[model samples]
Target: MLQGNTKILLLSLLVFLLIHPSAYSQENSGTIEGTVQNSSGESLPGVHISIPDLELGTVTNANGQFRLTIASPGTYLLRISMVGFEEKTDSISVASGQTITLDIELSPLVFQSDELVVTASRRSQLIGKVSVSMNTISPEELTSRNITSLDQALEYVPGVQVHGNSVNIRGSSGFSYGVGSRVLLLVDGVPLMGPDDGGMDFDGLPLIQTRQIEILKSPGSALYGGGALGGVVNIITKDFSDEPENTVRLYGGGYEPVRFETWRAGWGGGSDFRPRGGIIFGRSHQVTDSFGYWFSGKIHNNSGYLQNSTRKGFETYAKFGWDISEVMNLSMYTGLRRNNNEQFLYWDGLDDVLSPGSINLTGNEASGANDGLSDRLTILPVFQHSINPNIQYTLKGRLFGVAFRPLKDNGHISPPKRHNKGLRYGLEAESTIQATDEMIISGGLSFDENVINSDVFVGEDSLTVRNQPEGALFLQSEYTWNDQLTTTAGVRYDAYQVHTRSTATQFSPKFSASYSINESLTARASFGRGFRVPSVAERFVNNNDFFPLESNITLKPETSTGYEAGVTYISPILDAFSLKAELTSFWNEYRRLVEPTFVNELAAFQFVNVTRARIRGAEASFSVSTLDQNHQIKLGYTYLNTTDRELNQPLLYRSKHLLNGSANSVITDWMEAGIDFRAASPPERVDTDFSLFVPDAEVFPTQYITDIRFKFQVPHVYEGLDVNASFLINNLFDYYYVERPAIFAPPRNFQIVIEALF
Candidate 1:
């Protein structure tokens, strides 16, 4: 049933037959100019000057200049990245009216090898040609910690562990409350979930108009097929700054008021310490010579330190670009978010931690819990054509929708519920083929469709409309077998259907390798296969919140296989320091894993496909920097060893030691300072049958969290303005932890951010 104007006339005839009527004629073009600096010679503004074989690039302003204007004219290779420098490449030559000038320097890199990713091959490359274990997140780590949730900027990355949007990478996810999601979320590479709890709405993204966020831990269903069975993040946005611009940001904060008055009198009181704020607005322009646009919007409110945990929201993002010739290029993206929240779910025990109850499933205890509002929207359209420049062709389309409304106590307007909607639409067609500069190839073909109108997925066929459909086919390749080897391989084929059931298929395969033997050593390896299916609220939920869920329309589909190996080393030591080190080892294996049991003759709870697991791990990271590169320090560690090969032991909420640390310094020329640390090591097992529905399922010890920040860069605050200010502290020294098991994880907080740029 394809209506809606026949799916907008089949996506406008597939972007007008993938636009290409031959167009490429920039007369005799040629030009290049630069001024990047940084080996003690300062300058360096936003660096990144490129020419990855004519893909062109730019960035370097605010006095560090840069310009490129080449439409054609031979010989290239002109890199030069930034993010702590050291990545230069040069080898130029142009003819036909030239205009070259240069002066690039760089040097002060400590293992940041010129990132240019695309979520590990949905295109772009270089991040040392990725072979597993990737992470990137940087947009000043969410505006210097004034972070408005992207899971609090992934709770400080290293081997991730976030508790509310449930992520666990490397330990490979544990909580399965939001239905089915083994990490897979992308925007700017399409794929978005939660069309009825396939989870990952992480506040429905737009994280400060993000510009980079890659993640990609491992096992990505080959070229991304099912819910990526644990891996993939990819949210890359932010663009359109070729001149005209405007931006403004404002922030505020609170929380830091519980000095143990018996935990503020056990929070029997509602709403204490209410504060938190936000504001943002932006714009970018350019309207001719091939269009351009960019936009951002934000509005947040929090009032949450407990009691029904308040929250408010509004998010927005927009992007547009066009240049239909020179071999096409078109992009469009838009997102919107709306939220109202106020419904703390897991408390009321642990000595009434900010009160809100739930511990049902006959273990008894329940209390008012309902306050919500959500509305989300997204649209994406992309096009690229270039059947030149070593082959390229992409055509994507998407339209996502969401709705939720629950509110029935206080501030009333309506109640007794029924307004949950979700819809997903899609299309994809990708291809990249540099098919022979030592093999490049990539492939894609996708389709998706989902619809839901939930009652938490009423099942027993009391269904209130639900549909799911999916399709995929992927291919990948990357070969470089030289200059110290490189390799990659892939495959994917998926199929789905969930309403008139009976059609589920899977196949994903992968292999990877990277070797570099010298040049500061490198070695990597990977193997993968992944799958997941089951999520219409885990196969038709029949909700009761706190527990009493039941629906398992033949549930079954979860598979995984992953393995990794790594080694890295970078050096520079005594010439005034810069070093990097990495070591990794991972192993994963899961099969039919889906929990939420207790089906005593259907007396309740059910989303079965019970356990079979394995999760061996080892991770490490280290870094140091200095050499005109301000200062830096990093540390990472992870060690897990889960096993539940049919209840053998360990693997319930899995987390066996994880740590992360950081330090930054650049205390002058407009200030900077930082510190962060995180630790975890709890939940070795919490399944007393899922704690009979979690009422102080208590298993919280060994977790220390701290964070700190400060920054200022208020220079010439007006003309073409730029201003910045920051100060942050998060749970710093207020670690009364609980990352899982009764929910209490936030106590110390502070913030202040002000930014302006024009």
Candidate 2:
């Protein structure tokens, strides 16, 4: 054994000598020092501090002090982890013989359960610092929603509007062909958009794959760049952690309105000095009604339920991390998804209303469902490093491609191949600087390029065009004015060059001021300006002749000004129960709006810049939690109301009010259960053509839905191995209501999920 070891060592030395000048040609390195503290100024010891994906790590001493040594003069990622405190990461720059000091403030982990996030600026900064309203859906929350697509998970969030796979924020609606474009979706800071039109297929994103979903409810243009005119949706995936034994999850359920089954599996392992990688594969079988409010065009409780439409999908994602050294790290992630869907249409009514005798519709005849298929592939490569502590930087790039094909027979027995294909590429770089104990600065630049192709030509001459670019620059600064006050401000400049003719530029500014009234109460106010450009669908529909955004050089970008003020009060005196509540009111004015118009003479619709609208609303969330460590009970609620000044009515497809509540408790030493309920007011549809005098439809109201879940440890199983099962019943009481003009909600049905982990 000794002889063999000596031979191996000799070979390793020979290889090293072949690659370098000498083994002892030494190089100098530097170290970093830091301390951790909570809001109360108490030192937090045992905190894990290290450069992510690096071979170096250390723990905080009893006084919350840490030291790290590295051999590089570049940026590195510094991550601080603790059991009861939130995880914080920053980029740091290291110089030879230089010692950097960084003192960190971390919120308690309790907030993680509440789904709070701070990635809007490529760094760790809470939404409270921004003027916009934001909401976060934690992993726990995602599990509660129990749906596979982002479209279903965001339905309960306030100010977030969803119709099927389409999403819009605030009162910005009706931008793309019956869809909305006021929102941008991202995953791990990578833009999740198709290359051609800057929009995404919501269903193509898997909800179960994400560790967190941050929903910013205000125009994020000032930070997220263009297309953020409505808002931003950031999906953060799971981080690199200690290798797990294994994990498997399965779910199956079906009803007259909807049916679905899903399965997922993952594995991970590697040496201590080198980081590991993992891959996950998920497949699901889904089916819905022929026509309904969501999933399909057929109503749930009517004749369409018996003739359910079908949808099946597949998703696969992978992640790999490498530990180059203590000061540098690299990671790669990718995901692929495909969906096949069918939407059944009823032709009997249409045939009678139009060409009465054109076709025979009497005896249970069917025209078949429209066949639609969508596919997406996303690839991201990320590199980060922390030189020392005070400064760090990151480089991330993403390439996304999507294809959508719509096929229909129209009873003509022959249908041409019609589809849309798009591809998008994006890159970003961010730098964080801690100049002083009281100030921190962050800056970043983002660029996106899209290429789109549609079967039908657009414009006056019916021509096809491809390739467009959008870019932005953003910077944010946070300053602490003693212990009583803190202030944050940011600005972003976005530029969009149309395929032809003209370009639009916007400069958005945001500011927020907060005053700490003791340790348990705080007051804050924020203001900002926002703007958005038209979507590709609105600019050039498949079968319509519409001018590109550039041709209409005179068209103004949609703009808004907003203001909000709120106060948070927390108390822990009531029977060890904590009570926290916040109330905020906002008013915004929008201008140079775009709306779809009917070109009756041409037999198709066209997008035109026409009217302006003003919207105002208030929102509040209050929660009372009984702090029992192992068992807890909580109640929460939210309310909102928005109006469109031009139409003298409420905004379309938006709920006027919302309320949510839940309770959680430990059933045993290794078992737990939770129940949740939700309620929302009605929504309204906007009229697209005033000349026709067509009145908008009022969506029917809905009652609350209650859901339950349970988790238990399996006896005689591996440590930490447990099973989780949940039963969700939508329309808990069988409430009959319409979410759209003519579509009805699904009747009461139950869904079940089972998960096992070690």
Candidate 3:
């Protein structure tokens, strides 16, 4: 009873369906049968297995097994892909009418990859030969840990710590109240900090698309310029997935009741549950043979563990790729984030730690100054062209903007509203050329401008403006002396001019060498000069009298001379186990160190260049993995010796000893588990007079924290769909701790995560 057009449509649909699946049954066809599993030894279900050249694919079944047939196959490419794990591809030779078997193991993203690192040198180089102490966090690890912000994950990195939103590497920073971060943070090679805060924003980054985080523990100003005095953290975004598909992730969690009734918030039960959850919806596909796009949107809500600490956020991220021609390509990445947060400055006296502390409110202000709305947008476009095999260059353009407006949640009285509207834009071009077989040259030129209009600035009455323009030229040369020895030398010159001020300039230089002593060992050493320009905030911030913070525009830049030596060894200790270990020692001498100082005359705090300081440290870390890479154990230790030359005392807020460890195992085909531990000795000193302003302000104690997590996976939950459920317990011992004076660290908490990939 169907019409002629309907019959035609049905026939076309039937033909299209038969073409992919039935063609493999014909003569001379080849068959591919395979098993897919994670490096942790759990078989993966719902994995997409495909031969892109032939436009044929199959999904793995309940047992992580798959089979596919190809007609008229000679040689083809085989690819397997899944979410939360790395994709794998292989080349296969097909003999007519023959069945080929494959066993594919995909590694999880949490394990660091040392094959290539760009942060250390501003160019791709092998981690082993980079001549720096470099660490990496794989994307899978972030996903597995269910971290909602960037700072939360930094806590697990060796020799690195977070003081509020500021990051300290190798004891290079202290509690300066979110100004002038020594460690530079970048997202896909673009600076991530704003002009007003000069501090990292934890919640605005797009994590779902991050591929890897590279931590270069050395003076990076020679290559990255200012803000790299301590080191660099680069978050590399990912390329589109190999297969076109959609993914969904859902996670939720909350804290357990406080162990002590005295510390309970006036909420549900003894303590508020502080519920939190988030959802991510993502899709990626190829629009044509030469163009593709990937994007995701995330919405997260959190009740927070303390009063006036709630936060809600929404973010969207997208990436597009275009293979314009055989000799050129383009990549475009964009991100937008909107966030509302109730900031908790410090806890009330230890007796009522779950309550927000007052900020010396004046007038009839009712202590509700902790609310704010923030928005951020970033766009980066990169173009590359290949002149020849030895000559290729890239051009990058970027725009980063931030807007923040303070809000009052309850009754309040203030002189003026506070707002920050900032923008940063830049253009850079770089090239890599092989001068000869043993020599390579890399160099770049950059021009950037920063502008901020805000009422929170020291000299600003209402919405005043400040801006700085900068230009830089950098060059690096790498020479391979022989099969076992290599050296790199680089230098950068920078010029900066405030719109209304005179120009200032600096030159940074660096030299490093790496020697492969043997197949299993490598030795490296580096020396560099680093510098940091004072941020607009450090030079002009005015916290509106709630806090005792003032600004001094005369603050000088901070500079350092750093030296490092390290050795890496890969031991063939056992036939069934692989061991990799590293030991490093470093020394840094800083001059004109910028720190916050209490001005007795003004009765406020100010950023001042007050001291010459030194930080010397030793770090050791090792990892052991089974032959099958199924189970892993990692351990690390760091020792720091620091002194303020002007005061003859240890640097404030610098932990002398730190230790961290982790163990992971696959218990069964459908189950896996991991445990992580971190410990630190209490800082030698904090604010000498903090107790006068806030009770127990110097209560930081030697601390220990542990986390445990387990995952259960269901493969083939439906056709081409896989599901994984995870549970996590943080602060397993329920220990009370603080990273900074008077700031309450998170208590014991639990989380559940569900992820589906199709």
Candidate 4:
């Protein structure tokens, strides 16, 4: 009953299936099976096994088992790899119409120089092959150290400094309240910074769902867009597993009392002793053969050391994935968070070190109210399709919303009583083509729109809102001349419309080259251009203070160029020991740097592009580990020189020298201990022109701090249950120092954590 054309098509399809080499080979393919285990004879999931020549690979499931089908029977080399484990290679013979089974046992990796990273080039590649400087922190490392916040985790990275909520990388940024940020923060490749102020909210990130954190210590605007003028921090969340997994953690800690009793005077007569604690839960499950889901939640509370600084927050996250077919896939993520806290603008005077009071706090209102509350939600969806063996495309989109309320501000006479809300949506499409075995090209187009409504920022009588739109196009390529030489180049063009009126455009370009001197050594050099668009707050803020700040409609964007060269040596294991070292030097030049300038005649301040600056720095790090990976040591040092070229003076709030070190050892099968230490040569200058009540303070002095931690693990007492406990002592020596002008670092503190896994 079929038509003549339909019959002919069916016949041709039958003939193609019967005679095609691919179809015939698949019908007669052989099967390969394998299991992966660690040195302790425990199943290790997520191990990747591949036959490189055939361009085929598979990851082990929850049971550490994998199965592969080969199109033909022949001899091949099998390569197996996993992070924190030594790689393995083996020669095997495959017979037609036969099944081959093999088992592999891998040892712990002493030095993780070969770990794979994706943020460097937006593609998976060995860390050792990346041309830029970077650092990674794993979930295991976080657990061992009992780190609960992004800032705490980043402190361990070399050439990074955390001051309150701001991060400075290699002296690239000084303090700027909350207006602008040089370092960009990302969660699973999506920007997480607040669009209103271009500031990062470390607490908004779902730390409970993170598997790893990657820090790129170089400008990445060529690939990441704005707010990456200095560097980028990418937090990669965990993926779903084939089997069910659950984890729960609870931690409690307390801060030491103020050092000088006089500093706490005028505050409440009650004890200043404060307590903090948090609870985290995470779970993952495979719904079916091709579907998976992950969920995590966290609740935290802190009775801050300073008066009227208490805070409480909670966050929840979920992700779902579906493998629609062999060539297409889809994934979606959603998260919600809410936080409430008392605001502590600054100290009332030079002597009130531990007290919390703003400039407007009068003697009669010592215990007045100053509070802030925030709620946020985000949703992201992604789809991927493979058109052929060498071509693929991806589409991703995000929707984010934030509501912030300044409940009370005792500092201001008639505290605005403003409720600010912001909404943002973005979409991007990308394509990748493997032109040849040695060449790869990728291109992407992105569009974003943001809208904000506030009674304070915009005029109260004006019903119109502020909107900003952006668009970008980018292209990147990688080429390899041989096994020892490789090069990468990328460029991005971005256009932005501010206040639905003025338009601005920028072009960013990046270039890098790497050459392998030997199997264990590599040298690399890179150059890049970066820029940052002005934030909404910077252009339109009405605080109505003594030195009121006025909006600047003609403010220009901040731009910079940077260059870096580095050499890395990854030593091969020798007699159960290995060593890795890296040395890097970098220089950056900035033009049209945005900063607040005071117009003395007008008795007002305005944000303007009025300065040129330069920063040069060098960093060195060394890591050594034992064969069993039970003992390890790391050391790092950084030296920086910064100058305001136009002002002929040193930059403010930037340290000239820094040193950090850590050592860890497995004391027994169930116990581990570690020690961490850091020393910083204080800032060479301080900003005194701002009318923020900051005193005429001099340079900070050199200071050293140390911390010690011990962890104990208990094997499964019941089926599918394990427990771990940790004790940490921070600032072991109880050294007191000031990180910012009047902001003193906390004295010695202690924390305890308990974790259960199933």
Best by TM-score: 4
* Candidate 4, superposed: residue stretches over 4 Å from native: 1-112, 360-370, 409-417, 459-464, 545-547, 572-574, 696-699
Candidate 4 or 1, higher TM-score: 4
Question: Arrange candidates by TM-score, highest first: which order?
Answer: 4, 3, 2, 1
| Worst lDDT 10-window in candidate 4 | 360-369
The residue ranges of model 1 lying beyond 4 angstroms of the native Cα positions read 1-112, 115-117, 125-173, 176-181, 184-214, 217-386, 394-428, 432-444, 447-469, 472-496, 501-551, 554-575, 579-605, 608-622, 625-758
Any idea how many clashes model 1 has? 1
Tell me which residue pairs clash in candidate 3. Answer: none
Candidate 3 local Cα displacement, residue 454, angstroms: 0.7
- Provide the clash count, candidate 3: 0
Candidate 4 structure lDDT: 0.78
Q: Please, what is the TM-score per model?
A: 0.31, 0.74, 0.83, 0.85
Q: After the best TM-score superposition of candidate 4, give how far the Cα of residue 191 lies from its true spot, in angstroms.
A: 1.4
The whole-model lDDT of each prediction reads: 0.77, 0.58, 0.79, 0.78
Model 4, 495-585: lDDT tens per residue? 9885555887889999999888876678999999888888877777655432256667677788889999999987657667778899999
Q: Candidate 3 at 351: error in angstroms?
A: 1.8
Give the Cα error of residue 741 in candidate 3, in Å. 1.9
User: Candidate 3, which segments miss by more than 4 Å at Cα?
Assistant: 1-114, 265-270, 359-369, 410-417, 460-463
RMSD of 3: 13.6
Clashes of 4: 0
Whichever of 3 and 4 has more lDDT, that candidate is 3
* lDDT rank order: 3, 4, 1, 2
lDDT measured at residue 458 in model 2 versus the true structure, 0 to 100: 57
